[model samples]
Target chain A: MKRSSISSFSNPAVIAELAAHLHRNNVASIHIEAADGELKLVAPVGASLQTTHRATPVLISASQPGSLLAKAPTAGIFAAAHPLRPEREISTGSAVAKGDIVAFVKVGPVLVPVIAEKAGKVVSVTSETGTLVGYGTSLFTAKT
Target chain B: MIHVLGCGPLNTIQDLGRAGYRNIGVTATGAMDPIALKVGNLLVGNDEDAAGIEIQTFPFRIEFEQAQVFALTGADCAARLDGQDLPPWWCIRAEPGQVLELSTPMKSARAYLCLQGGIDVPLVMGSRSTSLRGSFGGHEGRPLAVGDILPVMAGTTISPPVNGFGIVPPAQAMPNLFPVSDTGDLILRAIPAGEHDLFGDDSERFWSQTWKITSQSDRTGYRLSGAPLQLSAPVELRSYGIIPGIVQVPPGGEPIIQMSDANTAGGYPKMAGVIDGDLWRLGQARIGSKISFRQSSLTEALAVERAIDAYIDDIRRTLPLVANALVAMTKR
Candidate 1:
């Protein structure tokens, strides 16, 4: 995970190669030093002509809202209504009181009902039935 | 020592990678899945990135020519050793006559097999890596086929110590995992490069809307197609050097992800590049998978770089020093 640095070079060939990677990754500043004092090949910002510039950054921002969902903290299959009966409205964001049956999921073979946390508008649903969803997949979201 | 079964297409010997040879157009061709290699190596007390077998899409079955400790990583292949199931990411000292079989993987696309001493192949151009494009390094620049028996270098100071089996720790020491698959949203953060301003705003926005990886994906590059971006005018640029993350957009307006073994120079217009740490995840992507792009600031990208460095430091701290010291000596 070290900041992999490429040896600085003034050769047009080497400069172009390094630039393309740095530019695509958006590496704004490139450190350049040469023993011969014969350094060149510098380009203006947004110089889209050279292969030497590439952007390389990833920024995580709070602007983009991410939802955290609660699950059984275990395993089970999912259902909208009670087992051995007809299914009903299971749309995400459906309102339900505390302790109301929100969905049922089967772990291995046994079916278990998942209770609602607090009353809220559903934001997003995570999985489909028997989809082999992992421990992290977001199940139907409830927006408070 | 062992008898290689099938080296799979494009399979060959590899080490940590070939480095410091960009002056001569030589690439640091190493394992596509470094996390797996690190784990397998750790299981057997071998230094990370030691030479091993890289099986892309496997049913790899190797007959043990000698008793040795071995481990598997990368893909969730149904590893059956002598007709018995074997646990993944754990080291096992096998009997001399044991034959290990790994069925085609179900979870991942590539599989890495790390042995106590590692697969010994001749070092060429300062590495044991195979660069087929140059047709030189590694087992004659080819995959080991049936009846190909690689003789392990005699008198290696074995690390896992013959009976060194114990509770293997987690493959990575930290939780900064480079995700293998994009959960339905195959998006990558990139900065505009050589051709950032060529396309009109509408066309550029359309690119992020719907683009799919064409079936023509390969080790050399990944071609994506959907709609063409309108350019201000057709400008011709001279050929220039290239890198793995470079994205080249042709006159037809198709974008391609240049990968390892990519040409050192190219003529087409370059677009954007996948982040370095994220590029490794590309190794596990299935063909025809959807890929999306997001623009990020250079400042943010550099921050991502720092976090990665910190994560690596955590893993390196727990590494057994025996192999690292020995490997360092040979590298010097």
Candidate 2:
């Protein structure tokens, strides 16, 4: 396949710039392709295609649970449960608050904690600390 | 029996792959490209998810202890059995002591080799896929090795190869296996998520404008390099549910997009997600490529779903014919 580069943002500093540009340009069809292992977005037409889009969440089980959730907003080292140093134990049905420091990450000098939401039995502790993580990646499971 | 002569960096038994285990913390560890697996199986009259061999980027040799019909697919490797060329996506009868070979990846990472009758490997969680990180399923949950004796069941009774080779995956249905872009940066269309306002306009601009992918990408997520992932509401928000391709920004300013094996929950501020269709691209991204993100409306994003469904519908159309042929063969 032919190789190419695509830059969606003009400023390349914040996504808002792209969002603003998208709103202004009204991007219709965004063509994101990978050339040479890189992903590029190529959509000359802006915003007009909204008419062809769909609306709905790919929900499973229930619409959602009423219980609060604890999560990692970004990627980093997960500290609680993991393959090597997994979180083997947690208090059963304990009421934990959000940002309760249930786990910690060592990204540079920042040691962020994997927190807890209003807790129940620690349903599960997913990955381990120092394991490469991603944004919106989870670390704990508290069934409320 | 199909015997392994020499395994490369990684090679393992894979079937349709493990599913429904994400909620229980297990990845759907299976062949990276399901379509290729199907092509190989179709040629050999094996179940698409049947136990077979997955060849990694590197190449190796395997010896069949008995003559068996088999096919290889994915990566377009130059395969040879006893110095004779082997056709991809086509079934062939190999004689015992024949040294089957896979030379190199033509345009992809993994490839599949399926015997006429599927190999009857024990299943784990209803699959025979290998989990590299966890190292627990599919042929001992690890790559293959030399001198390993693999069991192969009798080829299922099926129509002649004439009817099989007549089938071809539409060109569009073929996976990109290896992406053709070098921009390392992953462009994902996303919906504004929690903390959308917290980062305010200025930071969002940075997210959209200046960023490249870090060398730190894998099956989990891609890390962005640029201004610190700052938020307008800098206050820490409680964590919540996260999905593959979900873009989350931390205090450092880099936005990471989750992948197929991403965790189910998180604590960082989510700005948006890499659109679902583009997600598979995440699987092929090489490290240190440039990356960018765009906001997509719910309606626009669903367009991706519809597009994908059309592709699936095409595959579904062919299955009935194959299944019918199998039924007739069994009756005979």
lDDT of each: 0.58, 0.56
> DockQ for the candidate 1 complex?
0.01
lDDT of 2 by residue, B1-332 (tens): 87777777667787765777766667765655565676677656666678788776466788888867777766556677677544344355677787888887544456678887887677788887777767787667677888888888786544332112212332323334222234434565667776777777755685458467676765556787777657756676675766777778877777887764466567988877666666544444445556566667778668766755555444344433433422322232
TM-scores, one per candidate:
0.60, 0.54
Docking class of 1: incorrect
Q: Which stretches in model 2 have alpha-carbon errors above 4 Å?
A: A1-144, B84-93, B153-197, B202-215, B221-228, B235-242, B260-265, B288-332
- DockQ list for all candidates: 0.01, 0.01
Candidate 1, residues B1-332: lDDT per residue as tens digits?
A: 78877556676777767777766777667777665676666556567767777777566778998877787766667677777644444455678988988887654467777887766888886777778688877777877677788766532334432222221222222223332224564556677787778765834763456567787876677788777765677878997877777778777777788876676678887777777656655665557776677776677678766765654444344233322322221222
Top candidate by TM-score: 1
RMSD of each candidate? 20.9, 27.3
